[model samples]
Target: MPTLTSHLTSHPQTAEAYTRATQSAFLSLAGQGRLPRPVLSQWLSQDRLYAQAYVRFIGGLLARLRLPVAKAADAVEWRVLRVLKDALDGIVRELAFFEDTAARYGLDLAAGPGEASENSSAGFGPNRVTEAYVDLFDSFGARHGGAQAASVAGGERTLLEGLVLLWATEKVYLDAWTYAREQGAGREGGKTGEDLDGGALRREFIPNWTSEEFKGFVDEIQGCLDEYAAAQGGEGVQDRALELWKHVLQLEEGFWPHVNLQDVASTM
Candidate 1:
């Protein structure tokens, strides 16, 4: 049987969505250097907010971990905690990167949803999709589900679930940028990534997103997730993993500068 990640990527239900999330029209246009500046700004702005929520999401997972008393060699908790810490560090750096890139490119970090074109609707601050993403993050927090029963802890948004989420997001992101790096404006002729998309995308963003270090981080998280899944083997685990995988893929597919998600932005 395939690993969970491989299974999700290949499963008929998730395969198309995974492809859409990684090889989207938005990314394709970006690869071709034909993406409009305003469209890019809109996505960038929403992404900044998403990154902010990610910090809290990782923190929640860190807090929920119940490390064993003994400091066993290479304990799963230690590995999981380290990855979460790395996630925090990475996100902090990303926020700063966002600030620098936005200023350098004169792109508005607060660009409204659907602000891509004049005909598209515009709204202030975070869009519906962004808020929805945040909601999902908050749902995994230690305090989620209100009742706070010990039983509920493992029932709703367990540590395994949150870890899976973290892995899924990072996995999708790495693959998405890998796609960009291969065919983005950075390719072709003697063009360097810095030479295209005002240096924000092909150059800065794609390189950062597709870096070997980032790949290592993603791999570590995947190992951690798989380890936890195996250690926590039980009924409903696979079902929950599959459910969250599909959910994240769907959200990712919507997160792009997508026409199908225009209503999500407009309705907000």
Candidate 2:
């Protein structure tokens, strides 16, 4: 079986897109300047809340697995879950910091915790493509016999699916963060006009593409992918993970174009 890097590196177009979206989202936050300060501040507040909920959900899934986070396999399948869990924890911490900052800047993002039923994070919104993607992950998770029921009898497939789910989430967070950043910096800049340091706003809320978190994501996930490929003794599972990763890459590549241009037109 080819190594995980071999499978992912072989699929240049998909990998490139994923990498690009990750960075572009960060840059977009830095460059965005289309909305009033108040609106952008509120958006940041709402986004942080969303992050909190997302991490909580991921935590629940990890808790169901009973897998020690420091497991021996840097296996792509296990790593996918571990990374997802790590991301959730990290995002939760980051959101708390962002909330305090947004509030200091006079943004009110206190939305009553809406039930996931009312505000599902399954997709960009209620649409055919997003709905399909959500269904795909749901099926993927249940495919291993509903989380707790399955054993290593089909662990490989479950891990690949989790990686796909990770891709989907990264794609969405990229979009949402881009939207929030653009809005935050859209205010006019001048004395009493909008004295906010837009760069500071971005730095506080958006993760730097070059930061350890982003770089580690590529390296670690790839490592996991490669490890899984080696253990499975085949390339089929690796290919599937790559395919799902592509779905997310494409989603992000096409995301900014769909961002509310009208909402942040001034900053664009």
Candidate 3:
């Protein structure tokens, strides 16, 4: 059975986008501990905002999944629901991780430019890329029936699309972080040498991201998406997944440039 993962990999453009994202300079420099503190602080702040939105995104998806499916009592549906529940729990832990990271790095959680504006798309301050990503997730949630909505509107198709987006986002994140970990390990053409002390990023952040537990969560997300995509087989499904895969890559690529410390400093 061809999973959505297989289908996505079949698309050359999708594969290329994923490759580019994994190999991006942001990840490379971040792993090497070469990014300035201000830049990393800015990036982490934006990510914390994104993480908050992601909790809502997963909540919305869980709400959609709870609606009665055509196969009401299917074990697969139950399994997916359990997976989503576990993922929500995991996000809670992830949020705590971000909070700890911020504290350790002395990053002000509320320091970003848009923090004062409650009207911003993201309730927290968000850079443009973060705002755009939040809007995309919000639109999907609104279209499919938001977290508090009593009835799901867009149905299975919407659920599938949301799942694709979730999977793609996690996939890119895992790959990018894994790439960073590898680079930090001195595997990428001697980027991090043995002589220098491995900085907090290499010793702390990379380990947190590349841990076995985190890898397991990433795998669980991938499996859930693959199972759902395989069950919802059709020509249109692959196309939709591919489209979402590319969109996620584009969003991720756009996010890195916003972390440029030099650019941020130049404006100030």
lDDT of 3: 0.68
Among all windows of 10 consecutive residues in model 2, the one with the lowest summed lDDT is 111-120
Per-candidate Cα lDDT values, in order, are 0.75, 0.49, 0.68
lDDT of 2 by residue, 1-268 (tens): 5665565546766656755655554335334433445445433444554454455445544544445467576435566567766676667667777767666656556532223223334323333333333434444442334432232223433544554455456544544565554544543252222333334454554544234566566566556545544655544565566666666566444433223345454544
Report the C-alpha lDDT of model 3 over 1-268, residue by residue, as the tens digit: 5677877867777767777777787677677667556556666777888888888787767767753557656546676787778878877988898788667666566654443322234434787778777866765663444432222222233667777777778778887888877765654455333212235467567787778887887787778788877776766777666766777887897776434445333321
Worst 10 residues of 1 by lDDT: 259-268
lDDT of 1 by residue, 1-268 (tens): 5666566667788878889889886776565444556677888988998999898888888879988897795888888888899999999999999999888877888878664443244566667667767888877776776432222234567888888889999999999878866765344554443343465676677789989999999999988887777777788777777888877887887787764344323321
**What lDDT score goes with residue 88 in model 1?**
96
The best candidate by TM-score is 1
Q: Sorted on lDDT, highest at the top, how do the candidates line up?
A: 1, 3, 2
Cα misplacement distance, residue 15 of candidate 1 (Å): 1.3
Please report how far candidate 3 places residue 151 from its true position, in Å: 23
Candidate 2: lDDT over CA atoms? 0.49
Instruction: For model 3, state the Cα shift of residue 122 in Å.
Output: 15
| Candidate rank order under TM-score | 1, 3, 2
Per-candidate Cα RMSD to the true structure, in Å, reads 5.5, 7.5, 6.1
